[model samples]
Target chain A: MNGILLAMILALLIPIYEAWQDEDIWQKMLAFASIATKTSIMILVVSVLRDDWMIGLVGVLILSVGNAALMLLAHIIRRLNEA
Target chain B: MLENLDVVAIAALLPLTACMLVTQVDPYHALIIRGILGAVAALVYALFGAADVALTEALVGTMLSITLYAIAVRSSMSLRLGTLATAAPNLDAAVPSALGQQLFPALRQAIKKHHLRLEVLPYASPQALQFALENKEIHAVCVPAEQLATTQGTDDVAAPYLLNVRIPRLYETLAAALPPELVAVSFSRALRLTSAAPPPPDSQLQNALEG
Candidate 1:
């Protein structure tokens, strides 16, 4: 269980590194979305380990709503660029 | 065997490595990498028995973000510019100081100010330009100021700005951005002005009719 948790922690590092390296606005936004998803997944994993549905609920909410809003924002920005 | 920590560690490592490599790629490829990152994360969540989280990641992170990024990339602003061939000297030159040189800065200003994607094309003669305009091949045309003067009595010559009638709003935007001395003439008037010249041999319409 500890090893699985450690792996989850390590998994979170990728998006951080990607956001740091990428310069384009779209790529950066994508990296942030990745980070958000990973973080929510980590939350869910931790909640499952503790058998706490409350934290898991939070994770599910983030997973469902967070990236959708972010992508919508991206679309708006893209339309602005087109205009 | 499936519960072994080593297996889980390896699974997580694969995705982590993929995410790291994603940052090294160009923007276009980076988009794909980002999708992969989301998928791998979802897979990791599933392995850890976080089914809800995994499903969310797959839908939002992989599908939604990728679609949005694709739309953003696709929606980049584009403008097509047609110029008299002789007016546009060798653009390949290290420092081109031709008649079209002055226009470049204006175009650049418009792009930088509005984040526009512009393409510059050249026409061999006025007739070819007219044909191209009629076929909706270009958005705007730039002829030499002198050419406009010589074509006097034909129609109003805007000296540099002749916009397509299809996009009246573009005329306002371009007129405001371009030099004041440059006037904006309608497509029909511009066509009539150029009609004084003979037609070119190589156009899609002509090619189809001849062939």
Candidate 2:
């Protein structure tokens, strides 16, 4: 059975896999950034309204870091897709 | 109160609780619902009063949700052999601990009984415990839940009485704290509870076991 952590790991691996597939520095970076950007918006929406500020803050920080990784990947993927 | 869990634990528990919140939805929707719920929580912080945290959450969550959703959407394409209930790894970990689980509660109870504040330290080896004492993370070397068993005529380690706080049997106290589903039938998680008696010269329960 997939425990919660396993599921979460799988969830995280998606953008990483996509960036690897693109083979271009820029496209991969952008795609990676897009994923992060989308997730951050979601987190910001959530955090703006939570009872616990710290929890909301933690979620936001995690998303931001993830997106930054994707931004690096986004450049690669975009280039590969164009070529 | 969900007192047993620390903040990080609660963060994990909250998303899982979505199973109850969206009983009728498909798993994808359930995930979305959870994300949305988290987002809603963030919004509350932003709008109601905690803008600093709201800003912090806003940036990180945007990235995190991307990762989670990307994975979820991709996983849907595969012909997984089992459903989510059976397919996930490490499901057995859901069964919580039995003995050591009470270590915290027992300590707390002892402190409260004496009208004292509560502080907890990590479990460590004797050397590590010594280090912790030097660092002042712990004032005493706490004992395991097991009784202090001893054989005569050997050198028994004299027990130290730092503070007079007697912890009840592990089986007795945490028994109440756990859900009915998690209690194991035999040889629960407390490592010390079932060990052989320490021969006199080596048994530290001779001195430091009592707090």
Candidate 3:
């Protein structure tokens, strides 16, 4: 279980590095989406490991709602490029 | 000690992401990084047996705050430039005048360096254009000197076009970026004073140029 969690952490670093190094706004947004999803999944996994229903519920809510913020941001940025 | 190594590693990521957020130069990019930071923070809070904090961080910190901030930054970090309807025709139309062709691109390039977007608005007459500038409806006004000279019955206008900028910082940026040969850029003091004094309709451009 610890190894699985550690590997997931390593995977999370990939997008964080991409977000930092990439200059393009869209690319940074892509990295953000990846990071947001990955972190929420990690939370779910931790909750399962500890058998904590409350943390698991929070993880589910974040997974569903966090991407809504990403969609809103992307729409605004798309309109920005148009004007 | 070794049993909690994974928690220690996850907690360490919090500071690493925070550093990345601070080092960002662009506001838009920084906002995206901020979302990323919030995600990581929620994960950390959940790991520490704080489910409520994690839920709040995800709902309010990551979702609501980032959306609001993005909208605010997009609208505020822009330059509203007013020009004659005849000169621009429409916001997206290709400007036919030689000065428009050269000046617009230069202005876009100059303001782009400061991470500001350029928005062009067309007004029917010079009076309306000047009115917009005085009322603080727009940041700057661009007019053909020939048109103003024809209206005023004087050919003393030296430059091909005139650019009146109301904001001092914007005036400095435009003055530095634009060539004098392309257009005459001047700071307008009408915006600085109280709105009680109405601008004289006919010589508003001249007044803007002089004071």
Best by DockQ: 3
Query: CAPRI band of model 2?
Result: incorrect
Candidate 2 residue lDDT tens string, B88-206: 24533221132235433444554333223333333323344434444544433343223222331113223211111122343343335333332221212211211342223225434
Misplaced by over 4 Å in model 2 are A1-83, B1-25, B80-211
lDDT (0-100) at residue B158 of candidate 2? 31
User: Model 1 over residues B1-211: C-alpha lDDT tens digits?
Assistant: 5556644663765556574645453444456556556655764665566667777776777778777776675554557777665433674332223334666667667655555666666776777877787788877765543344344433544343443433566666776776645444443424534434322213423676989
Instruction: Supply candidate 1's per-residue lDDT for A37.
Output: 72
Candidate 3 per-residue C-alpha lDDT over A5-80 given as tens digits, one digit per residue, 9 for 90 to 100: 8999999999999999999999999999999999999999999999999999999999998899899989988999
Per-residue error for B90 in candidate 2, Å, reads 40
Highest lDDT against the true fold, candidate: 3
Docking class of 1: incorrect
Kindly report which residue stretches of model 1 are placed more than 4 angstroms away from their true locations once superposed.
A1-83, B1-76, B87-100, B149-166, B182-211
How far off is model 3, as Cα RMSD?
Answer: 6.7
lDDT per residue (tens digit) for residues B1-211 in model 3: 5888889889999999999999998999999999999999999999999999999998899889999999999989999998765444464452335545788888899899899999988776667766788889999987665444333332335666677799999999989998888778878744221113233323666877899
Error of 1 at B13 (Å): 25
Second chain TM-score per prediction? 0.50, 0.24, 0.80
Ranking by DockQ: 3, 1, 2
lDDT of 3 at B106: 85
lDDT of 2 at B167: 27
Candidate 2 DockQ score?
0.04
